[model samples]
Target: MSGFLEGARCSECMDWGEKRNTIASIAAGILFFTGWWIIIDAAVIYPNMEEFNHSYHACGVIATIAFLMINAVSNGQVRGDSYSEGCLGQTGARIWLFIGFMLAFGSLIASMWILFGGYVAKEKPIVYPGIAVFFQNAFIFFGGLVFKFGRTEDLWQ
Candidate 1:
């Protein structure tokens, strides 16, 4: 009896540990939203939160790819079976799901920060964090697109 759908588990590859993907994805999600908040924080959200520093959106691109790949790995697992390209679709689905979640949660966090205690990092801009965040999102975006568009494996094949 099948229990429940867990996560993406590719066959052939004995070592089945998408932990890195998970970490990367989570990091991407956090940055994507946080970065956005920072970029737009200065809007009406706060009387005085708008300030443009250096551009680090390039990093966002990387994070996006990471986020998408994370979804692909976790959602397109094929344990005790062959690798199927269909799994790619599963990964894409997972990515979208995360997107929905991020939209909802991101908004909530930004709103809370705007209303209650304004989030930090606004006072000063850090090049490192911005760069890191940009890359995380960038990776997720590319990874997901590739997975969705290119499904070479059957996951369990």
Candidate 2:
């Protein structure tokens, strides 16, 4: 945190940080959209999906909300600059970011639950729709984390 945030080092970091950040953002977007594509493909391909687990969709919804929350908070706010540097001037932003992470993790767990409990337990078809939902949430969770931490100076090293 010392040298990483220093002015001299930061100038060098800034030279490449923006490019790394953009690449990370693009990766996240690709993963997120790929997940949605899988889900949508399932819905369109298997129009007659019987006994569909509604909770699978719920996982995606929760992950989507978490993603939005994670993106809503500024990076400075997440680093507690709100309290120390009076940037955001409040601690609530940190709390919101924590809640967002929790939601993202919960969505992942819920997706696994659906995969095992609803699909695996019942011995569902080979191409189960639940798999798509699980993949969607998992991708979103990983992608969001990557996007969140990708800009950090430590990661560049």
Candidate 3:
């Protein structure tokens, strides 16, 4: 416990410690959106796709978010090395994951809102395509900016 590494308990790791862990975190982020798009395109849109043009943009948004989550988590720790990264090690990862949540649950909630709004508003379907794309892309673009800059942070180094 006299040396720096000694005082540095696994709990002390600010995410993945800018080591091998970041790589794993990055992988998870990539997989997340990969799964996201597959689910969205195959499961959701594939079944109820009335708006491909809109859905396509939405898919891009999902992909962008997925990219950010992977990097964000990577900022904290590697996939298998999460234990050392500390509680907030996954902060970047989780933030990205939240964006992914927006991509997924956001749509569901919007649908519900639209359904309710349909009764009140003149629109019947209430499902808007642009909205989904807007959120997804916005998240991705912003997330990407952070990831791009944060890549050189000391936490990961």
Top candidate on lDDT is 2
Strongest candidate by TM-score: 2
Candidate 3 local distance difference test against the native = 0.47
Compared with the true structure, model 3 gives a TM-score of: 0.34
lDDT for each residue of candidate 3 in 1-157, tens digit (9 for 90 to 100) = 4686666765465545554346644644554444445435433553444533333544454455455454445433543354476555556556656675565444444433433443226443534443444344444444454444445544533
True-structure RMSD for candidate 2? 6.8
* Residue-level lDDT tens digits of model 2 in 1-157: 6866697787977877668877888888888888878777777766663746444677898998998988777676667543354444447777888899899999999988887887888887654687887898888888887777765545433
Model 1, poorest ten-residue lDDT window? 1-10
Regions of candidate 2 where Cα sits further than 4 Å from its true position: 1-16, 49-51, 82-88, 152-157
Tens digit of lDDT per residue, candidate 1, span 1-157? 1332222233323333334344444555554566456544433233332332323333343344444444444333433232454544655555656664464344334333433232244544423333333334443444444343333343423
lDDT: the better of candidates 1 and 2: 2
Full candidate order by lDDT, most accurate first = 2, 3, 1
**Per-candidate local distance difference test:** 0.41, 0.77, 0.47
Question: With candidate 1 superimposed using the best TM-score fit, by how many Å does residue 147's alpha carbon deviate from the native?
Answer: 17
